[model samples]
Target: MGTTFFTPNFQTSPVLQGPKTAYTKPKTREGQAMGNFLIDLSIGSFIHHLYSASNFFKEMVVLKSNEKCIMELSRWLHDRTGAYDWKHASTVVAELEDKRDQHQNIEMRLKSSIRQVLKCNFEQENITSPVELPLADCVVSGLLLDNICKNEDEYMKNLEKIIQLLKPGGQLLLFSSIDKSYMIVSGERFHSFKYSENFVKNAFDKLGLIIDYCAVQRRRSMNECNDYKAIMFTAAHKGE
Candidate 1:
């Protein structure tokens, strides 16, 4: 729930990696070069990275705690639109769960923890490739695509693919950012994305996803360490 920021050093986060050989951009002109403006504009994606020094440690604690992991995965049921809750789930430890935790009664806890671990926001769809997924749900397995699809087209395609990632009744919790913001990482200056609420809403609509929570950035405080807070939530899934 802190300012989420990402960057080229993403791999060092112990969560989202910055680059991957398997992940590739669309081979077309516009798609390949989307970085001209849109990529630079899509700064919100990296905002999640800013979290490393703040709540990131708390997140790491949660990942190390079984109880916290359970509470985290329970949010997956909130994905009514078949989209995973990446922000809240970026730090879960479900892959290493023991066989004893897989029992039906304890399954919820295990799923919850694993679900949080799969909070790779970019990997909404199973397009990239089958990953050596930590034993969790089918939806979270599309991690490779989320990791590889850095470009906008690949991102949108991944979102589309996420529609199928969920089971018939699974939920999707999606959201996007608004307002322009800035952050500092590794002693370098960077900016958040300049996406409008409408832009994000329409973008998700392209894939038939819905919004369960809609909170925009408020001027929290100029004295705060971070600069921007244009946050929002999209928690729903393929409604059939």
Candidate 2:
């Protein structure tokens, strides 16, 4: 069976919280130019990460592994009625960046920055087959490889595929769970590939990405849904 993309209903998890800091504090290599576009390949339907990024990139492209996810996210972006409330997330972002007065309008700015929503399959040999996309200045992926890859080899291959979407010296902002083997979504258990911090660093090194900044936050609260020991955030850039 092909890999399934599951959209968990729970929001405001620790994993979701990490991206707020990541987007605000991501460090890139000196002298590297941040190009015009940024692509988001994150799992789940949270736009909290994009709030800070929208100000940096001229255009943003969000990719979902399936059409169902694309349609759902597209609706969430364009339609405010009955959409997931992002006000709290936006408020946190505004406060973090000292733009507290603009918190109420952050969502509207994010929506305007989005250029398109496209379907993408990271497991496929060609992640963007049939539809050509421009190489992005930056790529953001959160909790995607662990959920989709069955093992370390598959994880590396998929990571390579994600990196291929970047131009030379492009930045990659990655958020992942460390040493997690599974996650429970809406009462259904799903597989999560287990790996360590060193494994991820080694993979990035092998892929020719220079790690500029990395931080790990140990899980402080007990949660029943997922067994992630810690959350890892890495900011890396490709070589020119």
* Maximum-lDDT candidate: 2
Per-candidate TM-score against the hidden true structure:
0.39, 0.85
lDDT of 2 by residue, 1-240 (tens): 111111121223432354323223332233333667889998877677777777667699998886767877887888846666677778766776678899877878899999889888875777977788988888989888888899878988999999999999888889889989888877899989999999999999999999977777777676777888988878788988
* Candidate 1: tens digits of C-alpha lDDT, residues 1-240: 222221122122233233311111111111111000000111212222212222112211111112333344344434445434443222322221233333332333323332223223333244323332321111211112222333457656756655555444344434343353544545675544454567667766787755443444344335332344444544344544
Stretches of candidate 1 off by over 4 Å are 1-112, 115-128, 132-155, 190-192, 223-229
Clash number for model 2? 0
As a whole number from 0 to 100, the lDDT of residue 170 in candidate 1 is 41
- What's the distance in Å from true for residue 128, model 2? 1.8
Q: Which stretch of 10 consecutive residues in model 2 shows the poorest summed lDDT?
A: 1-10
